[model samples]
Target: MYVAVKGGEKAIANAHALLAQRGRGDAGSERIGYAQVRDQMGVLVARVMAEGSLYDPDLAAKALLQSQGDVLEAVTLMRSYRTTLPRFGVTEALDTAGLASERRVSATFKDIPGGQQLGATFDYTHRLLADELTTPELPTDPLTPPSGDDAMPRVTDLLGVDALIEPDRPDDWTDPDPADLTREPTVFPMSRAERLQALSRGDEGFLLALGYSTQRGYGNNHPFAGEVRVGEVEVEFEAPELGMAIPIGRIELTECQMVNQFVGSADQAPQFTRGYGLVFGRSERKAMSMSLVDRALRAEEFSERRVSPAQDEEFVIAHADNVQAAGFVEHLKLPHYVDFQGELVLIRQLHREFEERVAAARAEGDARAERRTKKEDSHA
Candidate 1:
């Protein structure tokens, strides 16, 4: 079905062969193994996985290696490969409240229920580039975790106790049938679930810019980082044969909940509204930015005036995917000889017409001068 066109087939094959060779840097350098890349370059692989919408670390590592460390290319490779794999079923909604958090912090509160645990974070460090990869001091004994159940309650739970922030879900909530973006053609006015899915897979830099715009009076979202948690949560799935949900495995996830002050609508009483973000792996910054933009897009729901690009749902969701954007932009590299020729022909014709108009105007002015001279001579 995917047979190559006859013209330049050998050239195309050779180009790809050369590209594969170049993936291994300069001569005499040892080739980087997939294991080393998967382990050492875990963060980059996680980002690729997030955008790619796939969870396989090995495939992401291979893609990264093949693409020569290009993130977008790796994501494209992962996305393309995903289409070939068959989907079994969707997983049940994850319970993030029971997450075994390694890093949890609350910017809104001085004291929280579990006490702030600053686990494995670069937030406090003065970011200076290291001149050398110095050996880390090895601990004599393995560090023991605090003796207790690791499942800590979310900060929003505490806020709900005093009725400070609005509940994330209504008391009489039922799971709505969500759309599969991979299959369905996008329709405008997408559901909150769809918007969240798109934004989660969106380019981080794009969302960060939009989120920053909101903070700078574009969307009027003065958001407080209620809580940011990085932890491992169990993923569950319901099997038809089993007839019950079972925990399949655990995945590291980062969640951000933003609290924003909202003026009460005519029907509803005044209360703090919340924005939520959840992403694969330890991506705190992405989670925070996502939460801000997510709330801003809900301007209509909150009955707030939408005044910024971030608040425009269609614009945000449509342009979110980097691969789509790159395809639209990079396609210019292909042959456009006919299109270019058409433009040149039109431009040249327009120039000739302009010159002719100028010449006609000049001739008309000369005739008028001659008529005026003759009239003046007759009067004298």
Candidate 2:
């Protein structure tokens, strides 16, 4: 036991030292700065913020540096830091219609208002990695503001005008007080707000897998990208003392609107259903995956059969958190001597019982043979 404890302590100390050395990289090379990570690796910082449920880019960058660029670790760090900060107030619902878009596109329509502005996207780039990017000189271009009208109407709204899609109902907005999952524990039959909050902070890779599963006929709902917009939107807070809303600041957002096909049910007519996704920063993949999952979770509302894991709310939300999943999975590597000893004791008892039963059966057989021999001798 002393050896086990000493060995474990020494091993952990060595592991930590190795990790620190690896995180610093080559001694001859310059160490990576948090500023460089924040500015150059904006996408990674954005991911940490989204998954961590915190919007501070600087904090996210710090977390990334501390975690050695492991996104899940960075997210955990940010989340831990977030708990120390006090809440000011909740922001009012954002108006995406008035957003100053950097990039906007729709797969369902060929041309829409504001046109398809594919801004700073990797969509057209080749998959090959360019080693030149290590110390590359970037080209400087004049900032060209988006031309035409700034108002980009939602594709779903256009469909709604033609009665091709379900109209946005007032009942959807009837939830006065939404549950805060951070403070309160998640209960069964979660509200839409709670589900969205969970998904926004969920691990992107897990959501991507589940979303892909839906596309592969698991919970097939022919979904199309109605609209994907990435841009800056104004955030406003309503103060009770002021009795009015006040603009706080602007935040970059990625919003996705997915139109899913739904057949006519007994209570409702056939119409295109909607799945919404909104997240911090420019995350198209995450937004799209989130929308697919959002629709899948609403199978009951659509009167569709829940035949897939995506439709299982308990499974999806419970396992969506990487921190929680990692803790439970990694805990297996810890000491389990007591647990194993209990199992060992039970196995020995079972083995002994089996041997005793075998010995008793053999003795009984010998006695029967002896009795048969005695009867034969008496007859002779």
Candidate 3:
């Protein structure tokens, strides 16, 4: 009782053609160039790089152009392209302490070693759209660094002097490289490295919502922004031929450290717990949200009961990819006539059977009442 529909191939091809035409805009208008996207849409390219987990700005820009400014699609395109590239040796871990910082702030202390520098942020800007942006004008002044040493001591390190912050635990420096979630399947009870990797490429909006929920008392951690820094760090890789680590390139990064209040447990002393976030480019919002979610997921380690969505690692990480979520939801538009017809047939059969049963019950009741009335008449 099912019929299959066919002949979607030609339609699909035509749809794709139309999509390409629309993506390019009208023939009368000037086409958007790759250079324009790379240079002008710097923030969008940065987002693609961060979410795609790739550092190639040129390729990210190309993906942006191809996707018609759809950030998630651009990220998906970049991630797909990354799989085609040759595998290279792992890079040495970066030292944030040595970063040439463009922006650094500490909410814990008003007077840190390096005074707070609010650089290129829209936090204080008015929300209204500006008319000048329709025809943009470049800034007249050249960029200049604020007066501060490049080596700004970490706020956490300052607190460590008083033993107020948790001390760093020594670990094996030669331990095997952590599992790459991109290549390997994600297993339950993931390591901190794996968890952080997932958050680095997670959907910004999803993380933002979870972070907001935590702040709204769903899983309040009383988080304080220990430090937020944006800067460039050199990427070094070990060269077997050179017998030393060589600087490959420099990448911009945004890092956030959240200090949360923790009460003493039976085995542990009362101290502030830390949640860390580091992402590609100047992604302050994503970094802050990642830190909040990171802290929420550590509820088990802290021996706290998981009572909110933010604390559910499986749920959060599984659905954090915008690409995956969109694909699954949008797949509903595909042809499902045959499957739906089968369900329709089953539903009709069930309705018929129900009606038959009801009719039989009614007939039986009527016969019994008629028989009782005849018996009463004979008795009269």
Candidate 4:
């Protein structure tokens, strides 16, 4: 008796239903509210925003809950949702100088203007495990007042006093809206914006690993975070038709300034240069790693020693995306019988050739024995 299996479509539908049920486990239990996710799971939301390229914490939180806390999946869902939203207009270029800073620190300066504000950070927090978060009201500290003149020249700005690094000025600001990496294919010799855009949306785990390799002496390059700032930067879009720049909105941005010490070569002078990194939301590690990787990418330009994984622009940037890498890696689960069959055929053919060669050798030996026996008989 033989049996044939059918109902492929039905199987897939059933599997999807099961998955949905599993994802929304125990509907009778307290449904995870969007606010709870946004406020409590801010870290996950931050990751989603950083990777999704969307800034709405509420949407990001919803995506996280719907995707069962799978950050990459949440990001994927958020990105799909973000694309469905109409692109009415671009926002104005955000001035970092005008950012409502939550956290700001400079490693390169002793005391720069607009003193370092370590706002809302877990930097110095003890890592002791807490037994319970069941307290009715969480303890909180009063929010620090904003520093006036918000425009404290960045630490890099202070370096110019001794002619070390380039000072930040209005003239240094570049146009933002003309380049949209999401809508276009990446071009060669990428701009800083393009690189940051890529890094911002890149897979966190992959980028972290690559960044780790660089620090572990895989590239043997030294780097310091000149500054890391997390704050809300106003996004301004210029409506030339409107005859003025309009403020569309603001986004929480984490920007990193990496300063690498290098002896300048032909195209550049013997002074400190800058490597920048920016991401949506507060991802300090990602931003700092991005800065290091960014500087490492300039190995050819800076004419520095190039022995690090970060220096390999193609390898680092190409593999930095978790979504793409994950998809490709998991695609092996799909049917691959055709390729397997081809390999099987080659193996069988090789086995047959080996057997034939052995049989021929045995036959030749038998023939030689018969000829010798006849010669011995003739001699007898």
Winning candidate number (TM-score)? 1
For model 3, the superposed segments whose C-alpha errors exceed 4 Å read: 1-8, 134-150, 168-175, 360-380
Q: Rank the candidates by TM-score, best first.
A: 1, 3, 2, 4
lDDT of 2 by residue, 110-199 (tens): 988667877778899898987777654545974443554445777888898888987665446674676788899999899777898899
Candidate-wise lDDT, in order: 0.86, 0.87, 0.85, 0.77
The candidates, ranked best first by lDDT, are: 2, 1, 3, 4
> Lowest-scoring 10 consecutive residues by lDDT in candidate 2?
142-151
Give candidate 2's error at residue 370 in angstroms.
14
lDDT of 3 by residue, 264-378 (tens): 6899788888888999888999999999999999899889989999998999899998888888897887678779999999999999999999999999999999999999999
Top candidate on lDDT is 2
Model 4 lDDT tens row, 239-265 = 878978877777788888887676667
State candidate 1's TM-score.
0.92
Q: List where candidate 4 sits over 4 angstroms from the true fold.
A: 1-5, 134-146, 166-177, 266-269, 305-307, 354-380
Cα shift from native, residue 10, model 4 (Å):
1.4
Global Cα lDDT for candidate 1: 0.86
TM-score of each: 0.92, 0.87, 0.88, 0.83
